[model samples]
Target: MRIYNTRTRAKEDFESRLAGKVGIYACGPTVYNHIHIGNARTFLNFDMIRRYLAFAGYDVTFVQNITDVDDKIISQAKQEYGDELASGAMSPEEATQLVAQKYTDAFERAMSDLRMLPIEPPGAYAPRATEHIDGMIEMIALLIERGYAYEVGGDVYFEVRTFGDYGKLSGRSLDDMRAGERVVVDERKRDPMDFALWKSAKPGEPSWESPWGRGRPGWHIECSVMSAKYLGDSFDIHGGASDLIFPHHENEVAQSEAATGIRPFARIWMHAGLLNVNKEKMAKSLGNFTLLKDVLTQGYDANTIRMLMLGTHYRKPLDFSDSALDEARAKVERFANCFRDAEWAVRTADVSEPSEVSELARACDECETEFRAEMDDDFNTAGALGAIFELVAALNVLLKEKAGALPDADAADVRHAATVIEELAGVLGLKIRSNAKETAAHAGEQGRAALRLPDGSAIAPDEDSMSSLRDSATALGLTVEREEDLVLAVLDKRAEARAARDWAASDAIRDSLREAGLAVEDTPQGQRVTPILSSPRDLAHGSS
Candidate 1:
């Protein structure tokens, strides 16, 4: 596999330090607040990378750190309550723990909704920054002893001049960066470009006893210490969003390498591109960022959000908008439907060995090759996703030609395609599952039973009741299907034809439905047909 190394600014063949084994450390969130969609993008991108590696038959150890202590957390807590000890006010420790757990739980829910697979076992080894203070202190002392860091007052800062290759990853010169130093002027630093390794703890804030006195770790040092402690002095890959290339990752390299005397802190440095909102960087300061919970509450599926992020290349900036998300939702729905249909065919179809099946298998293999090749080349997820879509389109054409008489081999190819897509997606932490008829049936029954009206009327619906409802609707010459929880009535026969996989018939049905103010969705349980309203309609009347 080939991956783009930030250090060289070029794609290179990936070789693990240990044969067939990979150790990867990704910079995780600083849990001061709920992570926004932009922050989640980085984790999703790396999850895909890790998943791909493991799918290719490698043992991968993925470690992502949680930065529990930071200036942001302290500042947020102070803003929430006037004083640390105010009655009913959350203390700094309590605030940090509460907010961190809440956001982490929120993040996990978002990941689960997106079907992301966890690389490590649940809570297996997610080391928090506050839990690894001693490691950070040791590294700092080593840097200071080597003259790579200097203590100014009670705080300690990494001396940028001492590290000659400081700007290698960012492709920035010290002088050029110094010119922009006025924006980040820290009077305590020896040079304008020098960044903090440790900050002196403020009064009534969290602190750890270190060689540099009572202080907390600097932003960059946290990752270095935690990563090195978990993955070793030199690991296979270190990844984060592209924004970390500067002082964050660059300083990590300096402190890690200077402390351990390792030529390169990590063999590969992978960075995903930033997410943009309305052609601008999404930042809290800009007041245009969308939180993960807010987006989920707005009724967008988590998988839809994941697909939206994956639609763009990992190394390219992605533009976020409702239109983009809607398009992504449509595609995801289509993919899910295709997989469902293929699985259904597999279970019901007769065994067959045909030349067409072999041809389709060849096509699937070629698609997988293209997908992996694109991924190997700098983790180009956009190209990889395009390859999967192309394969899905081809399978759709095959199903159309065969009229759902998919041969055994062709069915296997379809399954393989799904597996490959999911495996690659796993690298990005996307989970794709194909639910068969039995599971769908049970879920439909359970879901319907859970829906209760405010008036306490039991709307008990069985298959017979559903069939009666269908017949009643059909008497009006309307197509309909009754599932446990839903009454799917097709206002147009053409729409039913489409649901039955008759494209021509379905197209005609869609036009007729549109004329009759109806829209259709082919759900797992059954066809979901609804009337399109110009304005919102009350659910009590069931007219909408």
Candidate 2:
């Protein structure tokens, strides 16, 4: 495998520090407020990278840290609790804890809503900065002893000049960076580029007992300490957003290497590109930043959102637009339908064996190889997806030609092809479920029952109505056979409506099915009821 290293500024063969194990540490969110869509992209991209690595048979341990303690959290906490304090002004610990818990819960819920893979217990190991205060103090003490950091007043600052390789990761000369330094100038620092390692506690603010007096570890030092504590002084890969390369990541390199005396803190450094809106950087200050929930609530499913984010290569600037999302939705729908068709072929196939192998057979046989080739080259998800789409196209052609049934061998090939497509998609974290069937099965008794209107009226099962219904069944636990029966019954009812020329009822049912994630298409072989994956919005939630 190959990966682009931000430190080296080139793509290099990806080899873990250990033979078969890879440890990755990605900078996680600072729990302060609801994360915006841009933040979601960063998290999702790293998740994809982690998933792909594990998929390739590597023993991967992914670590993401939560910045529960930070300047932003402290300020926000003060604003939220200071006014409510009746007695002594709210303590920093009390306020920070309150805000951290609120936003941490919010971040967890957002990740769940986005359908991101769990980063705990079998997923990535998420560490809280506050939980590793001891580790931070130990590292800071070592840096000071090693003549790499110093203390001034109660605060401890990293002596940037002490580490000769200060700006290597960011490729900036120390003199050039100091000249362009726009950070608030601290008068006590030996150099203008020196940064805080431990911050002196202000009155009524959260602080830890450190040799440098009561203080909290600085942002850069926290990551270095936590990462080393969990992933050792050196690990396979370190990842974060490109924006962190300059100051945040560069500082990490300096602190970790200086404290541990390890030359390379991490073997590989990967950074995902930033997200933009209307060709402008998505920022809260810009007032154009959209939250992930905003888009999901607007009727896009997690799968569609994932498609939109992963459609472009991870290193390319992905412009978030409704048009791009729509295109992604269409592609997702197509992929889902292709899978459905392949499954149908397998189910309805009857021939004992094929005289000659089909094109789909070859496509399926080559999928893993082609997919791995694309991913091995810097995790080119776009190219990998192209390979999956090519197979999808082949399967579609085979299904179209072998409409009625397939020979036994042909059926086996088609089934293998379908499985390969799903396997490859899973590597990219694109779970291609037959949305309608899954929704119906998972939607539960109340959800399935709610398919009817309050007025006791019905029509083609539209996409809108079904989406609303499915949303209500989030995290549903049900049976596929039951959902299949429910969908089949609805399809039969629609067929009856059409046979009787009851256009309104037929259309309503069709629309409802479409909304519910079932693709209702009229084929020459009669009406084909294929479950189409729609957005996260309820099938009946906002339908007209």
Candidate 3:
């Protein structure tokens, strides 16, 4: 495998410190508020990287930190509640923790919505910075002992000049970093380029006790300390948004290697590109805020969001817009349709010695090989997605070519191809067939909404309303057992109304089905029933 090393600025052969083990740390959210789409782009891309590594047979240890204590969290706490809740007056620490936990919970929900890799040993794998204050203190002390850091008042700063490789990661030079020339430097520091390792405690902010009085870890120090604690002094990869390279990740390299006496803190540094909204940088303070929840509210699913993000390479800036999501949603629908059609062909198509089954399986194998090739080229996800759809298009042809049940061996081949499709897509952390989970979860409420249509006896598929579905299916000359089957039966009844020129009845069928989280398109092929990827219930709740 070859990975682009940001530190070296070249693609290098990737060899883990251990033969089969890989340790990766991606900087996670600060959790001051719900993450916007731009914030989620980094996490989503890294999740894809992790999934691909695991798919390649590596025992990957991935750890992402939650910055539960930060300047923003404290400030947000003060702005929201003013040091008091309905229960009573709150302490400064209590308010900060409250705000942090609230948004930390929000971050978790957003991660789930995007189907991020399941983090195990939740606490250790997703450590909070506040939980490792002593580790940060220990590192700061080591840096100070080595003359790379110094304490002033209650604040501790890493001395930029002492670290010879300070700008190696960011590719900045000492001359470019001269504070008075191009940057602003704190007056208390010995040099303009120095950065804080620990901040002195302030009146309404969170702080921790250490050898150097009470203060909190600086933003950059939190990741350095936590990653070293979990992934070891010298691990395989450290990653975050490209925006973090200059000060945050560069300082991490200086601090970690300096304190540990290690040449390289992380063998490879990967930084995902930042995202924009219609070519404008997305920032909450600028009123350009586009929360992930709001995107879901606009009736797009996590799958659509993932497709849109993967449409661009991880290292390239992504310009997001509604039209882009619409295109992504269409692609998602294409994949979903292929998965559904392949299953239907396997279940009911006439049995015959199909000419294309072996070819279909070959297509699967070729897609997998090509997928690995694309992903291996510096994690080129856009190219990988192209490989996926090529296979999708090929599989769709095979499914449509045959009209009857496949021969036994051929059916198994088709099934194997479907399995391959699911497996490869899962490597990208996408669900092709499991979308039914979302469909079923919100059936009850959407069923109620469907039943509320004017003069409509729509099929409400909730268990309480199953009898209505059964009667409707019987009237339509169908035996429906599952929710999807009932939806098909509804389409049959809707087709009946259309055939008889009952325009109102046809309109009611379409509207009622749409209300129940299904879309109906009267194509030349037939009345196509589609389960909307976005759930009405979930759209009410939560993004990228």
The root-mean-square deviation over C-alpha atoms between each candidate and the true structure, in angstroms, is 9.6, 7.2, 7.7
Error of 2 at 6 (Å): 1.2
Higher lDDT: candidate 1 or 2?
2
- Candidate 2 global lDDT: 0.78
Could you tell me every candidate's TM-score relative to the true structure?
A: 0.76, 0.81, 0.80
Q: What 10-residue stretch in candidate 2 is worst by lDDT?
A: 436-445
lDDT of 2 by residue, 268-357 (tens): 999999899879878766888887756754556666777888888898889987778778878888898999787767775664443336
Query: Each prediction's Cα lDDT score?
Result: 0.69, 0.78, 0.78
Top model by TM-score, which number? Answer: 2
- Stretches of candidate 1 off by over 4 Å are 81-84, 87-91, 119-124, 183-187, 352-357, 404-544
lDDT of 3 by residue, 200-315 (tens): 99876767898888888888888889898888899999999998898889999999889989878999999999888767777787778678866754556677888899889999
Model 1 C-alpha lDDT per residue in residues 207-277, reported as the tens digit of each score = 77887788888889888888887788999999999988887898899888888898789988999888899
Candidate 3 Cα lDDT to native: 0.78
